[model samples]
Target chain A: MRKAIAASAAVIMLSIGAIAGAAEVKMVGTVQKIEMQGGAATVTLKDTKSGNEVKVTVKDDLTLDKFKDKRIVDGDEVRVKYDDGDGVVTIFRKTAGC
Target chain B: MTKILFTGLVAGAVMASAAFAKDHPGREYMEKNGYKGPETCEVCHPGKAKEFLSTVHWTHASKVDNVENTDPAREYGMKNRIYTMCNGNDIVNNLKEIPKTPDAKGTKFSGCNTCHPGNHLSDVGSAGPEAEAAIDCLVCHSREYDHSKRKPFKDDQGRVVLGQDRSVKAALAIAKPTVKNCMTCHEAAGGGVLVKRGFAFTKENDVHAAKGMVCVDCHKAKNHKIPTGFDPNNWAHDGVRVACADCHTETPHKDAEYNRHTARIACQTCHVTRTGGSFAKDFTTWEKLSNGYYEPTTLRKDANETVPVYAWYDKTVANRPDFIGPKGSRSDKASRIYPFKVFQGKGFFDRKTGELLAMDFAPPMSNGDTLAGVASAAKILGIKQYDPVPGWQTVLFGSNHLVTKKNALTCNNCHAPNGVLRFKDLGYSDDEVKRLTSPELYLQKMAEKQREEW
Candidate 1:
């Protein structure tokens, strides 16, 4: 009975994690350029591993603040988690030691 | 039921984000309504705004009449320092008023006022409550501030001033000044990365910047007055200073012999060996290019491994208002050997009164005429025509960045023959120079001392 309960909990946690993972595409890279238009901003990033450039649009007010104020600029490495479908970043932070 | 649950989950996430807004002293009403202007920030934090208004970041000088400086011919921030860049201060002079003359007809910008929060060629945002609307609080506080979008406009008094994007969302993003916050202005100085200060924080070189230290970490601001050690070639300091020993111990090194050197050696001498990679400008002159636009002629440049000039510096050299470099000698107890990045250039001087030349970025230079600008500046100064006195001299700036333990000097660096230091040049006698250079003799002395200890 205890073994069965443990297996059931494991399955539920895996199911929840899969749902979250499927909705987001995560990456880490250095910023190459950031272009803002109206309320929308597009950031081009040079992938740290693949060495390929990926463009991701950011619409959140908090992330937009970082771009406008130059917190995230060219040559600064950042970690990003974006929507898999629309490629809009949901979480963006600088890859810093602190 | 399933659709209802999904909607509820979305609402919960939204509420969680709203709860994350910084709980601070900002007026609650302004968060809902849009930020009215730069003056509104002062309304919420009246004390902080008052303290910030007194800073060099706001006034450019420690003491001066905000509207007019002691010398009208010179620009507002030219103060008493010698202008070394390209032999003239015009490259950065942000004058308050554009001269009403044909020579200045094409001059749109008073000078390079890009970094200042006030944005105006002069009159930084607000000198008092009257100028508060012109203040750009985000430029120094928010990492997300976009200074390139900051525009110049005419105020109620018809004076041209700089304005910023004063949205409420930008205002709410304020935090302590980060290294990134300072870089929006500092990195852009001298028109390129690491060109002006030759100090950039990177994981490979700087342990402080890499460990996420902001500029305010070392340049600690007390009541908004950041302590900048004086540079004879630049500006004066406030009161306090930024020193390595403030954090590091008097005897930092574990080894007794290495630790003993702390009495006469600055931390920067062994650490900051090179800066501004090979492309960094060592020589700059206002000599016009073939295109006719006034630009600096760069001479010698340095890279990551470039050797720096060495000098004996007094402990208080950085605090002195008149001399950027302190006069020191081997015999001086308060002195230490320091490293300097020696910059060289040429510019004009007044042969009659013997005054160092400083002038506005005259309209002629804006219209791509170099000679006209100099002539216009002379007319403004009410002086006779001038000639380019060979301004060629070693203008030394402290080499205090690009620190790395990887390239730190070994004992042979100073003691070995053909090492980095020149013993005779540093006031050492011939016998002393011989003794300092000869490693065999040094080894013998060490052996004798070791035998005695045993």
Candidate 2:
């Protein structure tokens, strides 16, 4: 009997916790342009589905061997996840990459 | 056998001498000054040392007009006491050190007690004959004396006994000194200067001052204490230290927080410094640092700190295109949430009307570090997916006074779950802007163009 009561209580607490956590959701904005030599870039399609404007970020990717002029440019939209403005973005496919 | 008798006599002599030292000065001084006696007070009251110290009774005598009456000069020697009675410096040093005492303008220090009597500091330990006691409480409430103590009734056998004990009498028998304590000093007739200013001092009939409150209620203790010294004193006999907060909890903030922020921020945090002006006049200005953020300048006693002063950062807000405003708005003005906020991140107001909506928010800024964190959290909470409104600081901060009968800073402004959290009489709403204004009124008008377009 005690085991059954304990199990029931645990389930109730978990349900309440889950309900409270469902209120807010988080997402990140995409980076558009990367000024390679200057270490900054202007990007479009920022966070929030409602935003039409893009954001800018500095790039420090070591793997990109073509360092000179290969950084991102204006109008280049990329899928990025920002955790407090820091995170990795797997560029699914660089489209309209200038 | 002779040695035994001598030892007993010596012990008795030693104990008596110690007792004499413990209870002599107050009694001797009273007797020399023709005081009735300390026994007169002890007759009407018993076991009141605790309560007496807690009240104005113990301190009242120290404020008597003739400082010599309360603080009779004592001789501690050439280095210490030249000629004195009680330690007046202890009482004088505790009050504010104003440039001049109100009544005694050329004088450096004087308080309300300069008119009243019985504030003798040494009387706390007064002991001795009957006459001295009558002069103490008798000067004010002389009617309480039953006279039964003086003429001891003898039995028919001719043996006498102590008369009606004054020590057992109730505190109410003293009549509470109505005409003397509050009214006498407040009227300026009793010699306190016009501290209240413009208001008819006598018209109020001591309504605010009568209820055990004194001039020190509004005046700073250091500025009002007798000798004009800022030395901290312990008011609580049980060891609780008296401080600015002992009386100033009337406003939304606490004294500890006031002392902490007084240097870094402006003094108008909880007070109405100006005669009649927007809240911004008191809290105007925020400096926008080159790092795409705004910071408040530290206030100085001599001058107002300039706001929106750019440090010419190598990496100023010039690079951030996302900062929304007019196309060519100066980064200095556009970046910071100037006109600083008193509530930090704990209050909210109507985005339009400069009227306060709600205050009494949670987690009082424990310190500057915690304040920064609260500001950051408010920014994140205020952000909407694509909302054009700046962070909460820019949108609502310093815009209105957070008006709530409750704690004056809280999330209730927007989250009033019930509509009760509003100053409807003043036409203010929670989480809504009916009108936005600025300190000079010009910015509010100028900003109107922006608010409308946005």
Number of the top TM-score candidate: 1
lDDT per residue for candidate 1 within B111-226, as digits (tens), equals 55545666563354246664454567777775445554564556788866666767776666666776667765665455334445656565555756555455676777888788
> What's the distance in Å from true for residue B233, model 1?
3.3
**Over the stretch B49-120, how does candidate 2's per-residue lDDT look in tens digits?**
333433333333232211121233331111111011111222221222223212321212222223223322
Q: How accurate is candidate 1 locally (lDDT)?
A: 0.59
Q: Give residue B387's error in model 1 in angstroms.
A: 4.3
After superposing candidate 1 on the true structure, give the runs of residues whose Cα lies further than 4 Å from its correct spot. Answer: A1-98, B1-28, B63-80, B86-92, B95-110, B119-126, B153-159, B230-232, B277-293, B299-305, B315-324, B384-390, B440-454
Model 1 interface DockQ: 0.07
Model 2 segments beyond 4 Å from truth? Answer: A1-98, B1-44, B49-135, B138-173, B177-244, B247-454
Q: If you score just chain A, what TM-score does every candidate get?
A: 0.73, 0.33
Per-prediction CA RMSD (Å): 13.9, 33.7
Q: Write the per-residue lDDT of candidate 2 for residues A9-98, one digit (tens) a residue.
A: 999999887666543223333443443445433334454365544343335332121122232233323334322233322221121100
Specify the poorest-scoring 10-residue window by lDDT in model 2 chain B. B78-87
What fraction of the true Cα-Cα contacts (under 8 Å, chains A to B) does candidate 1 also have? 0.13
DockQ of each model vs. true complex: 0.07, 0.00
lDDT of each: 0.59, 0.27
